[model samples]
Target: MKTKFNTSKFLAIVFIAGAITLSSCSNDDEDNNVVPELEVKTVEDLDGSQGPVFFSLSTGTAVQESATTWDIKFNSSNFSFGNGAEGQVIEGIFENYVVAPASGYSADDLAGIGSLYTYTGQAASGAQHAVLPTPGRILVVKTHDNKYAKIELISYYVGNPDTNSEAFINLETRPQSRVYTFNYVVQPDGSTNLK
Candidate 1:
């Protein structure tokens, strides 16, 4: 007896082949030039806090202002705070360091330093606490009257856990040594200012 062909099996094979063909054809239409969207979330610190506050400086301008966030464009990598004694000192550098204007000043201008300043009080009622330790001391050595100058933190130590933490800020300079003090300022945004 002649067996009836299994139509369903044939149809299944045809369907499978058609699906593979369509999939291969459609894949080529995908544009490789299309960039995938990246979702970046801000990570909080270990203390359930946000990152440190940042400030931006105006190039060739003496005036500076506080910023909620810093953009790469107006700020230089050289303008940074050095790690404290606990942290390793950068190679070929001293532990305590400061920045001065590259030009338009004499050796005296460079010689005269200012105190580094930082905040040291409890968080104000409406102020946000900083994740990083604020500077509590400064040593400034300014010899001449204010003509033109530029300065920024290169690195510093935040006090140890056993001791109270402190940050430095330049206040003024004396003849023998730089007279720096640790002082804090309440900013308009209710954040502490550490110069």
Candidate 2:
């Protein structure tokens, strides 16, 4: 018995395969560039030894720290705060307690301060490089390799083991007071604009 080639069957198979492939490709648009949603890193347990603790923020990574690296207090009131070694300089008055942004706010946008770590208003006296409870301050930091980043302060209090599940350090005074939690994004090319 000789088997004859079926043109209709071959054409139907090709058409179905082509349709399937085309449908799959049609679902996605190649031209629309997507910006990744950066995260709000909760950095905790900072060193309270009256010095500058340096770190980097490249990809909006979360930070939870305890020990500090440097030994100089970088006040934000001056232009040349930390010289060059340290990257970030934060200074502001503390609230009754620190908290995250209310809602409907983009952490990526830094339009209010104009530039990173540039304060708009003066905090009260006894203000240092501590995280402010409200979202009115921006901390400008240079990465270990000289990359610039802006961190929005979220909170400055430690979380209780059984309650208040925000971002916990260990305590709320002195050494633990130096601890901080905030959201941050890095500018790889050291751009002045944060957004």
Maximum-lDDT candidate? 2
RMSD of each: 18.8, 10.9
Every candidate's lDDT: 0.26, 0.41
Off by over 4 Å in 1: 1-4, 31-33, 36-195
lDDT (10s digit) by residue, model 2, range 19-49: 9988877755443444443334555544333
In model 1, the worst 10-residue window by lDDT is 82-91
Please tell me which predicted candidate would have the highest TM-score against the true structure. 2
- Candidate 2 scores a C-alpha RMSD against the true structure in Å of 10.9
